[model samples]
Target: MTTPRTRMPAAARRTSILVAAAEVFGQRGYAAATTDAIAQLAGISQAYVIRSFGSKEALFIATAEHVLDLVTDAFRTAIAEADDTRRIEPLLGAAYVRLAADRGALVTLLHLFTLGQDPRIGPIARAGFLRILAILREEAGLSMERATAFLGNGMLVSTILGLQLPAESEDPATAELLEATFRENTPLVRELFGGRDLDG
Candidate 1:
């Protein structure tokens, strides 16, 4: 006999669907991912997923918002615990790298960023990107140059993971660049990427 499924509370179920949506959307991106796939991943019916999120676009927006929340919260916590203002960038960088361990969310955020041309998602994506920059500049108290550099480095990390370049590339130049880029967070990067051959 099959065991009966335990009913999850509405909030928990919604969260689960979002998590599953992130994973699916991260892999396939916004246009390609479907409610059916999200529902399958979340172990719910497609109709239920629609009822919960109202639509795929709504779900994508929620997922994108969730991604921003994760990034902002990580930076906020790092900033709060930091003693030296100069160390803000490094602390925030480390915190972001740590969050990358949740690969789905990281990739989902990146994917959402690329949807800036979409009428519905574009505004959300632009606003989210600006919010992160604002936190680095305003909240973290980093200068414009510092904030730009920090964001550049973070984007580099995202590109490295997105292309799986750290694990797949065999070029010495690529490896060297990655090494220099992630020199400060090498261990955390390695740990997050699961001992991948980042050495090329």
Candidate 2:
């Protein structure tokens, strides 16, 4: 006997598609990634994926925004859960490290950064970067210098994680870079690498 198909709520189904799209777009750049792959991964029909998001471009944009939301949401959470006596920088850095453990989302955001030259995605990418900067500046009360420093470190984390460099910890250069870059979050990043899901 065949098992019955599960029915998900519309919101849940949309999120599911976006999740699959992120994985596809993250692994394959937007120009190369297709809705069919996303549909197959999502266990939905390509027509349904189009019906849900209108088109591939729209779906890519949605997925990009979704991952940006994940990053910003983590920052907001760090801000909210910050210890009164402890510095917010380390807390925020740890939060970024934990969230960056999701290789798909991190790579997707990096892909989005590259698409900043595309007419369709450029403005959105710039706006997303500024949005994160604003949050660090206005909400987190970080000065421009501190925010820049954090962003620089975030880029390093993204690059290291994207390249799976931690797996090369035995190498002197990679080990030194990861050690200096992650510092206290080194163990956390190494442990969670390819181990955690963003949606979790």
Candidate 3:
């Protein structure tokens, strides 16, 4: 029932809105970002933004959720399809490394944590993480607690990597060095999973 003309405009507007939100959310963070500013960046009025998205928080939530969805899909697909279980850590590492290249996701995450302890965002982010952990746990046959813990640690390391490195720092030697460090630490992951051969 929708014509291309109508659909095209809607799609364009949505992209414009998201792009504006990413810029504001990246620079000032979620809590500090304002709808007025986002609208200004988008070259639209605040009312127009509110009509499209309910509020600044809603916009941030959409942006964060969008990035998380991509991460979840790419991560699960890459790890699940790989022939070797030993590649899980490195695969996950590579996923985050790729995500870090997306300036929007990195900035969104940095701003998300900066927001004061709110029960709303916490559950959403937590649920997304738990879902990923559940996938890893179910696939890897790891216990719930162990899976969550191990994935938590992995995410922490990935966050640190995202924060410390620039997006353009695409050095094969650096990646190899990190991968080697990950390989060397297989014993630690094994210990975390109740001494299982996760690296196998």
- Scored by lDDT, the top model is 2
Whole-structure CA lDDT of model 3: 0.64
For 1-200, candidate 3 gives per-residue lDDT tens digits of 86664334877887788877877787777768899998999888899889988977788877777767767777787677667876665666556555644556667765555453667777667766667777677765557776666566665645544444222124666445444544554333223322222112
Cα lDDT of model 2 by residue, 1-200, tens digit: 99997789999999999899988887887889999999999998999999988999999889989998998999999899887625687888888877766666777899889988899988989999999999999989998998999899889888888877777777788778888998887787667763434333
User: Which residue pairs collide, candidate 2?
Assistant: none
Please report, in order, the local distance difference test score of every candidate based on alpha carbons: 0.84, 0.85, 0.64
Q: Which ten residues in a row have the lowest lDDT in candidate 1?
A: 191-200
lDDT of 1 by residue, 1-200 (tens): 99998888999998899899988988788889999999999999999998877999999999989889999999999999899986777788889988876777888999888889999999999999999999988899988998888889899988877776656435777767767878777666766663473222
Off by over 4 Å in 2: 1-6, 194-200
Q: Candidate 2 overall Cα lDDT vs. reference?
A: 0.85
Q: Rank the candidates by lDDT, best first.
A: 2, 1, 3
- Best model number under TM-score: 2
Q: List ranges where model 3 is wrong by over 4 Å.
A: 1-12, 113-116, 139-150, 158-162, 165-200
Model 3 — which ten-residue stretch has the worst lDDT? Answer: 191-200
Q: Estimate each model's TM-score.
A: 0.89, 0.91, 0.66
Residue pairs with backbone atoms closer than 3 Å in model 3 (clashes): none
Clashes of 3: 0
